[model samples]
Target: MGKLTDAIKHLIIINVIVFIAPQLLQLDFTNMLALHFPKNEHFGFWQYLTHMFMHGSFAHIAFNMYGLWAFGTPLEQMWGRNKFLFFYFSAGLGAGIIYTLVNYYQFNGIYELFINAGLTDSEVLSILKSGSTNDVRVVNAITQDQFNKITSLFNTPAVGASGAIYGVLVAFGLFFKDAKLALIFFPVPIAAKYFIPVMILGDLFFGMTKYSVGNVAHFAHIGGALIGFLIALYWKKNQFKTN
Candidate 1:
């Protein structure tokens, strides 16, 4: 909205650094910093926090940082640095955990199908890891589509601050419910209260269905919004007490 506050400035600087440093140095931080499937070998505990700073592409980081600055500026100004930091990180962690839980459910459902078809644990793991099932029984038990989904889920690592940015967007909506906003594709301005819920619903619809536009982690966005809403609600209700 105006010049960045201290926390907002520092957060943007860190995100930019994380985005640019690896490319400049020709270093790969995907396995170490990007969030991966819990069952994947490359999965790391620290990625839940670190992945918030990692991004897949320039457009991805640009959008996220812009959201952070645009929406986060008011919140940081209202809540001050420490409180804003707590809310931001809490939403991000919630996003990672929720995303992982959803993946686990889907992965295990497919895994159970494999087990029910008489494949052993090791055999199922082997098939998932190798992305091939020569055994007639395994092939007949699960369709190629199912095999591909589980494999892609296992191998594709999630990066970027979209989750945290989604959290900021939600908070912005709550704080400035009447503020006009619009998406790039749909530029007609709408009140934040109306627009944000629609946005989140779109994510939920895409996350549960097969129509997701890109390699987006929709559930992460949902998770962050959920956490942001709860925290912002609590703070709003207890505003006098906190102050």
Candidate 2:
């Protein structure tokens, strides 16, 4: 416990503080800090970093913090504080970028659909701008409007540290490939290298297949993994050159 890396310690502390601040101060800190995808119009450039520290619920924070503690301390120890922080923020930022791009494409598709269905340009623009259609009748009456409203919410904010944690999981897999990890409350043990990738692939499959799971940003997980893998590859190449 005392051997935890400074990065991990500070991250845990901040997450805990953010989690409890709302209850203590009676403010909706998470909603305010969460990363609203670029299309939100309300999105700011800083949310990419801020959202990783904000979580929606107790269970959400618990799972994210647990993943961070389980995987992050070891990676931080190996990579050192500055490198770990860099990798963490990089992964989180990458996640936000990928999520925003995906949301933009989806929003455009919906926008085009609404336009094709004879909804006025203003109506479509209103949905894109505010994410509220204001009339369920319009949605029910026009299939395209329903689709537009549904996809508009996709542009809503994504809040949590899971993306960065997923990046840590990737780093752990690469550096501690043979380390055994056991699922929480389960007796089965699996190697970190294989386990983490499998989990990532599972997330990809589910993310692609299921779109209705509200507020879970699975593509951001993929984005984190991709960034981690690329960073690891770059370090390996540079190490070879240095040697």
Candidate 3:
């Protein structure tokens, strides 16, 4: 295991503080800092950045901070603090943007269905806000599945550093393609080049399908990996290094 680099150390510290401080203080920061749907009342432009520093639970922060420390140490060592910070935030921001875009698409698609079925904007908003519809017309306008999806899209907030850490994993793979890594579920060691792509592919498959196990923001992970791969590939091709 590599020693904690400067950037990764500070990041983990911040994450820990953010995770614990709110609970101790009996304050909730989710509505203010977590990434919410664009149409949601709680959403703000700054959430794209702030949400990276927020985490949902102890296990969530633990897993993400571990990934950051493990995979990001080598990256911060290779690219100086400034460059590493730039890359990390870039990937995180990309993840948020891509995630929002995907949600917007889904929201709009269902919205059009409601509009085509002759529901007014106010009626649609009421249904979303109240999570119920007394009007049979509104009920007939959209299926239960569509209603559930749209409700979840608006109500659920995305919070964590997983996106940034996913980027770190990609960079690690690029820098140490031969490095062997294994997951808890699958303990067999595999080279970074092979493992990272397969992991990302799994995220993509889960993101596109309804078979995902939990409340995973799979698209955010895929977005981070995509941005990280692009940036790392460009740097590799040009032989770029911060130091």
Candidate 4:
């Protein structure tokens, strides 16, 4: 409701710098900043926090920064800068952890199937490392379908602020449940309480069924929302004073 608070401003500045620096400096920050599967060589512990500030495109960062300024400002104002930053990073790290867990679940199934089909761990690791098994010489009859699934899972790296923004969205709904809101996909005005849940449920459905239009990390979104809900629930019960 007021001018961009300190934490929000710093976050936006950092995101902008990180997003642009890659291009200006001709650096491949993705390898270090983007969240990757734990088994991947690119994976690192710092990525859990860094990935929050690394978005995919202009539109991606723009939308997330807008969300940060829009929903996160109110939260920062209420929670103070330190607590807000802690919550923001917590949600983001939690999202990455959950996203990785989900990836493990999905990829493990494929890995196990290949193993049962006579593919060795070394063969699977090679496939994952190469991001493709098409050229790899394997004795197992790796079908095109199976190859595609494994490649997709191994190659898909998540980079965005959507997770923490989703956390802010959850807090917004809890603190301002009656606030009228709408999404670009559905512009009709709706209450924040219902709107947030609908968005989370959509992510859940897509995450569960593996039916998404783009490279949307649905599990990360849901994970952030879940953590945000827990934090908000705790705060609300304790009646954290904003004043």
lDDT of each: 0.90, 0.76, 0.89, 0.86
Whichever of 1 and 4 has more TM-score, that candidate is 1
Give a tens-digit lDDT track for model 2, residues 46-115: 8888998888899999998888888888777667788888889898888888877776775675566566
17-119: candidate 4 lDDT, tens digit per residue: 9999989989888888899888778889999988998988999999999999999998888989988988898888888898888888878877777777677
Top model by TM-score, which number?
3
Clashes of each: 0, 0, 0, 0
Q: Could you estimate the TM-score for every candidate?
A: 0.96, 0.85, 0.97, 0.93
Which rank order by TM-score, best down to worst?
3, 1, 4, 2
Candidate 3's residue-wise lDDT over 1-243, tens digit each? 477888888988998998899999999999999999987889999999999999988899989988888888888888888889999999999989998999899899998988888888877777787776767776877789988899888889999988888988999999999999999999999999999999999999999999999889999998888898899889989988865
The candidate 1 region of ten consecutive residues with least summed lDDT is 234-243
Native RMSD of candidate 4 (Å): 2.1
Against the hidden true structure, what lDDT does model 2 obtain? 0.76
Ranking by lDDT: 1, 3, 4, 2
Model 1, TM vs. native: 0.96
Model 3, CA-based lDDT: 0.89
Ten-residue stretch with the least lDDT total in model 4: 132-141
Q: Judge candidate 1 against the unseen true structure and give its global Cα lDDT, from 0 to 1.
A: 0.90
